[model samples]
Target: MMTIGMIVMLIASVVMVLASFLSKKTTTDREKSSPFECGFDPMNSSRLPFSIRFFMIAIIFLIFDVEIALILPMVMTMKSSNLMIWTSTSLFFIFILLAGLYHEWNQGALNWSA
Candidate 1:
């Protein structure tokens, strides 16, 4: 069994080495190597200004994503949990989510247009 394993390892190593050599690119192209951004040159300074609105929208998306993750488990736990407690907890959680959405909406974070 040990000898068979050793032989398999040897064969795998040889095949990997050959594959790597065969797959190696002969020449590297500057355009292909750099990141593509809507046909824009990526060779320029990477420290470009980022949009604050875009960042805020991303953060809001992440927060809701996490909240959805938390809420999904509650559905499964409903079968085992007390009905009254479960109802209150679910309602409270949904209320909080709505409140947060309202706050962001009022603050104009949800507005795409100025």
Candidate 2:
């Protein structure tokens, strides 16, 4: 007997193959083929300059979000059981977090008035 994981994988693969075959006759035209821009033509040659600060903030957010996801489960486990585990995990997570915050502070990424 196939395991549940294997049965699910097989069903997923069959569905994907059927979807691909059904979509083969889709039309192509100048409007359909060209890059879509919300029905707007590409008129401008040079794009506007974007500040790296916004991108930096987005990257930093993603980093912290992932870090939180990884640590929250462990943190919760500590909270439910023992104070020693709680203190150790909290200190470990906070230490690296503070280090990252210090780096960002020094590099001026945290500055919004720039």
Candidate 3:
């Protein structure tokens, strides 16, 4: 029974891999592969320098946003959790987050202008 099951699995895997390869064409088209820019030819390089301040602010916002999302579930689970432990855990997490924020602020990554 195990041999039969293994044989069936092997056959299925071979068939799926063959199907994928058979579906792909060897033909290559430069226009199709090149990135589109509103149907216009690209005059400049695609890579551009991004603002570090903007990137840092975006990362900070995302970190806080995710923290809020995680905290929401803790609120729902609070009734089931030990009060003292929960409060201490929550305070520690927030303190860590604030510490990170303070570190970033001290590094001047939060500043927009040079």
Best by lDDT: 1
lDDT of 3 at 10: 100
Model 1 weakest 10-residue run by lDDT: 37-46
Model 3 TM-score, 2 decimals: 0.66
Residues 1-107 of candidate 3: C-alpha lDDT, one tens digit per residue: 99999999999999999999999979988877777899555767878799888899999999999999998998998999999999999999899999999999989
| Model with the higher lDDT, candidate 2 or 3 | 3
- RMSD for all candidates, in order, please: 3.3, 5.9, 3.4
Q: What is the lDDT of residue 6 in candidate 1?
A: 100
For model 1, the superposed segments whose C-alpha errors exceed 4 Å read 95-114
Error of 1 at 59 (Å): 1.8
Model 2: lDDT of residue 50: 88
* Residue pairs of candidate 1 with colliding backbone atoms: none
Alpha-carbon lDDT of model 1? 0.92
Estimated TM-score per prediction? 0.63, 0.60, 0.66
Candidate 2 lDDT, 13-108, residue by residue in tens: 999999999988667676566666664565554466887888788888999999889877875686477888688878888899889978997899
Per-residue accuracy of model 1 over 12-108 as CA lDDT, tens digit each: 9999999999999999998898888885668777788998778878998999999999999999999999999999999999999999989988888
Global lDDT scores for all candidate models? 0.92, 0.81, 0.90
Q: How would you order the candidates by lDDT, starting with the best?
A: 1, 3, 2
Q: Which stretches in model 2 have alpha-carbon errors above 4 Å? A: 1-28, 43-48, 79-82
Alpha carbon deviation, residue 70, candidate 2 (Å): 2.1
